[model samples]
Target: MGELKLMKGNEVIAEAAIRCGCDGYFGYPITPQSEIMEYLALREPWKETGMVFLQAESEVAAINMIYGGASCGKRVMTTSSSPGMSLMMEGLSYIAGAELPCVIVNIVRGGPGLGTIQPSQADYNQATKGGGHGDYQSIVLAPATVQEMYDFVELSFDLAFKYRIPAIILSDGVIGQMMEKVTLGEFKPRWTAEQIEQMSGSWATTGMKGRKMNVTTSLRLQSEDLEKHNNNLQAKYRTIEKEEVRFDEYMTDDAEYILVAYGSSARICHKTVELAREKGLKVGLLRPITVWPYPTKRLQELAQKAKGMMAVEMSAGQMFIDLKLAVNGKTPVEYYGRMGGMVPSPSEVLGALEKQLIGGANNE
Candidate 1:
């Protein structure tokens, strides 16, 4: 344990980045997530940890900077909101295509186009289903609490490097601005040049030290080569889907009705579970921690036991499609959401559960 401290979710991410021995951070200021860069700038980790913190002129530049650092086999990251993340889609696709390991945090706000600076889960489709122009996938982690926001930073780095792929911390304003007590983890030293060479020298651009130069590019001009690359990427994605599906099942052992959610929506659904339980309803909450891999196996298993399921979210049911596919007509699955920066309260969720799942409205 490093220390126990009260902190906001965004600030915790910054602190954890430094503690995790992150080599570089490049980002533009955005609402609900500006605290990440602000804290890093204030702490000046460069002086103590030899970390490089640079504020890019735009999100476009920031993600490209991450590309540059990650090509050199350095642990790099960036943070942004919904609109800013949109701007980074091109770079994100390139990073995925090149198989660079880096973390990108999106403290999501409501948006189709700069909609609002309030919390939202509308980016579910964008985040999980290739936000960029490629047949690629990024590992997406959704944190429901401040502690998770801190912990996921380290976890994201590890998974990113292990898989040689981009990892995204898909959070929202509700969690980003919320405060909580968190126990920090021990500091891990940054990777040395020798270690980088040993680990990623085959692909990473360390240098031409006694070997051929390493090239990191997403360009595959030839059709046969591009097809081969796509096949390899697809295989990796399948492996990730098999090995990395993570979720938290709350009171689901004998649940009759299940509620599926992630991020802040999961936190709210937890309370809704309690409220429904008090009303003698057998409702459980399935909170997906890894939104990309999506706990589909668990959902399929639960479909066998539960009568039906409900997808609760801060969006207009983006994740509902996955739930429907997971259930596969075995049991009914309905969607209940509050979009455009509106967060559904416990009472509202309970009401929806009663009307949609338990009250025979969806029984037919």
Candidate 2:
């Protein structure tokens, strides 16, 4: 077994960044997510692995910093809450339009504005639907547990670099604050400038010594050229949708009712599924690991088998839109959610499932 220790979710994000060979972390402190930077500061990984951590002046500045570092092909990242993320939207658009690879973590809080510091999954639409202007998609991962909070940092970087697209860890305050025993993985050495040049030199702006200079920007003045660029981006997103969809299904083989959710909501729905099964209802869970490049194909398959599906979220039915689209009227799709940082209990979810999908006369 690897090293095991009990740790808060936010702290592990820091540990994972250092261990995964991150070049830098440029972020502003925000509620619930502030510990990510604090933990990094406490560990002082620059002394050990030469990692760099800078608390930026603001979220906008921090996202631009991420764009700058990613432009050079460095594995850099930033973290923020909902409102702070709103400030970074334009920069996120620039990075995506430029097609740079980087990781971003959003420890979601409730809201349209400065909603609350309480945990929420309300950022689902923003994270998956490209909150930034222009047409683009980031590889979005939702972690339901503290272990995933650690594992996805490395995975997000790998996927981001592999596709040269941004990756977002769509976590919430619940996972960020919750403590759990996580098995630490082996460390990867930070990449050298030489290594970065060797790996990403084709498009990365390493010093233009031996080859043609690499120009990175999102500005395409010509309409036709911008259209072509957008088409290319769309093609990349299609490939990702085909190749990188990830999810976990529980008790699905025999299930007649399916509960679809992601992140913290998925954890609650899992218990709801069990509670339902104990009462002789055939319920299952479809927990999405990758919210973007969503597991639509699997959901479509589940729709054929299950009597009905319900999407549960911490948002006001954001992912429910996707769930319904995926099921495509083959079977009924219902929604259960809580907003403004309220979390539903397992019993509440189970009650919703019965009322919405199972107990209804149409479902029966």
- Clash total of candidate 2: 0
Off by over 4 Å in 1: none
Q: Residue pairs in steric clash, candidate 1? A: none
For TM-score, the strongest prediction is: 1
Cα lDDT, model 1, residue 281: 91
| lDDT value, residue 5 of candidate 2 | 94
Off by over 4 Å in 2: 361-364
lDDT of 2 by residue, 203-317 (tens): 8988897889998899999999999999999999999999999999999999999999999999999999889989999999999999998999999998998899999999999
Candidate 1 has what TM-score? 0.99
TM-score for each prediction? 0.99, 0.98
lDDT score for candidate 1 against the true structure: 0.95
Per-residue C-alpha lDDT of model 1 across residues 1-364, encoded as one tens digit per residue: 4699999999999999999999999999999899999999999999988999999999999999999999999999999999999999999999999999999999999988989999999999999998999899999999999999999999999999999999999999999999999989988888899999998899889888978999999999999999999999999999999999889989999899999999999999999999989989999999999999989998999999899899999998899998998889889999999989999999999999899879889953
- Per-residue error for 72 in candidate 2, Å, reads 1.1
Each model's total of backbone clashes: 0, 0
